[model samples]
Target: MQRKRASHYIPTSTMELERLYRLLVLAILVNVVRGRFLPGPWIYAAHATFYGAEDAVATMGGACGYGNLYQSGYGTETTALSSVLFNNGLGCGGCYQIRCVNSKYCYPGSPYITVTATNLCPANWARPTNNGGWCNPPREHFDMSKPAFMKIAFWRAGIVPVAYRRVPCVKQGGIHFNLQGNYWWLLVYITNVGGPGDISKVSVKGSRTGWIPMTRNWGAAFQVFHSFQGQSISFMITAASTRETVIAWNVAPPSWKQGAIYMGGQLG
Candidate 1:
């Protein structure tokens, strides 16, 4: 039997070499092609093929722009202006404005001021459903994935207080109690203050005499009308125990207040 040896075909002319190079490049691209490119796709070109350029531009906002595009308005000066960016670049007309906010159009849904989380507690104890301050939040994004717990300090707009009072809690204990249930709520409070300030993590001990997992009710720094209301969380101890629950709120931050007296009463 005779074996056929593979032949290596080489191009001759410059044109042929270029053509071969192009063909090889095209083949590599074809082999790697899946659906579309990442970071940004060419959806507009596909739309234009079917709907035409003008129609595609009007519908999906012309190419190169961030969002939907609109034409000039009635008046000359007003009409002269380019696109206006709105809704996080959702609506664009003639001109572009970075980070423009339109109060007339309310951004629907829950307004949650997302922040990083802490180790001692679950994510829920971070912030409330509807709560925010007058000034814009410092950072645009809060990455919860890093660190045990994020230290969020909130300060009020104005301030004027001489001798701040600190309230004392009658009983320092977790609020929710389940002798043989799945979940429990921790409600602790603090007293003696005059303005918004920071609060540390509270220690929770179950009736069975084991320290239960407890996190801060609110962020580290927040404005309290008067006394501090710690976070209400659901948690389980290393092992379930039932005797007489004893919980206490300890100022977590400032390290010095590690074992400071808690003036707030504990409730479920």
Candidate 2:
């Protein structure tokens, strides 16, 4: 009778082990290729210009399409701006923290400004022109409001090269829920949000109601007709960028003040 010999495992060398580890990492990255391809913030040499109530036509006809830039433009202290990039154009409602890195027109000090994207940059306004315009040569340009522009650089320095990054809206006191409408109807304006700040949907719950959906009235305002109108309000808000819901428990009391603001922290 012939005896069969058993096969033994071969030890791998250090180099071979390293190669396998590298291969494993590559595989993991390949598996998440879709996420890798997802859109992210990109840098631009935007020529920041000021725009505000003075501008006749914004890309969305003054909707600003995203977060609440209305507060920023109220009377100037809270500056705002617009960008030429598609992600930064009208309806983007994205927030950016911009700093003047290095520019011939940049003043002595380096200043950074966080602004809500509310408009679009005109293709023609890329650089300062002799025709009383200081913007020209489009692409990667920012048409900011006078307030936002002054935050980063002197207005006289018209166009300054800046470094900007997308960041969560600086909701110092978290989210702001503004109550509106009569007791028969429940309405809320979700503002001062962080992250990809634009809101996608909102839902509410009450002592008797499980979860009542709200419709987008306009901009970031949400509305729903429910019997819980004067019974206090608790709602969930979904962020447009992350598609995540933030729970605002009993945010609004039964009183339902028309212009009252309730503070709640964002999803950190």
Candidate 3:
């Protein structure tokens, strides 16, 4: 179960105290009217902006949130995205649903757009006057693709206030496990995680060795001390958002071809 953080605020005046009392009474009355309440996931509201980001095709050393083999222009109309929370490793490869909720730019027929977290937005540490490349801090802000932003509001409008929450990545196929390099020096990239699909930890267990923890090299390719020559390997995949576990037994056999993708089940 998730713990809710406690927050304290200073009271301003008698008017604010009376407003709080009214809100408390209203909450009790609403609960009495409704029976059998169930808690749901939290949804956050924030402002969002747009830019055409091809971060996956980064010329620099920074790896894309996806694997190395990700094509530059394939499915970019929907998938191209960027985020401000890239410092946290868990934020990469995550999915979110954002809807236009406020501001004059939001039209009546706006629909929520689902975007995959791809690149880290540029920080404003250098220029204090900048707004972190359209990412407003202290809130769960998103800097999305042109297609995604247009779906929420008109392109003529620069920014729109939005409400968003983590959602499952509804992809076409199951999770894909890709092996890079040779059998002696193995690097793994697991992709297409479904629900709030931020990978927190990856562990590998070979025939002889116990569970050996893999250090995150970049986005999805976690690295381990490569030693397996012919034995099969199993993997423990930990989902960051829900702390769920999925194990793929013998997903990769020795003599694993470089860039060969093995299909595995995904988190719900």
Candidate with the greatest TM-score versus the true structure: 3
lDDT of 3: 0.65
Candidate 2, position 70, lDDT: 51
Count steric clashes of candidate 3.
Answer: 0
After superposition, the stretches of candidate 2 with alpha carbons farther than 4 Å from their true spots are 1-42, 52-93, 101-103, 108-110, 118-141, 157-161
TM-score of each predicted structure versus truth: 0.17, 0.62, 0.71
lDDT tens readout by residue for model 3, 1-268: 9555569575579999999999999987765443212223536556676665444233222334453324411243233233445545667666777788756788686577777776555544454323444443444566666666777788677767787766666655666777775656678877776765678889988887889899887776788867866778888888776666778888777655677777676666
The candidate, 1 or 2, that scores higher on TM-score is: 2
- Taken over the whole model, the C-alpha lDDT of each candidate is 0.23, 0.60, 0.65
Listing every candidate in turn, what is its Cα RMSD in Å to the true structure after a full C-alpha superposition?
25.5, 9.2, 11.0
lDDT of 3 at 268: 62
For model 2, residues 164-196, the per-residue Cα lDDT tens digits are: 776765456667787778767877766666666
Q: What's the alpha carbon RMSD for model 2? A: 9.2
Q: Is candidate 2 or candidate 3 better by TM-score?
A: 3
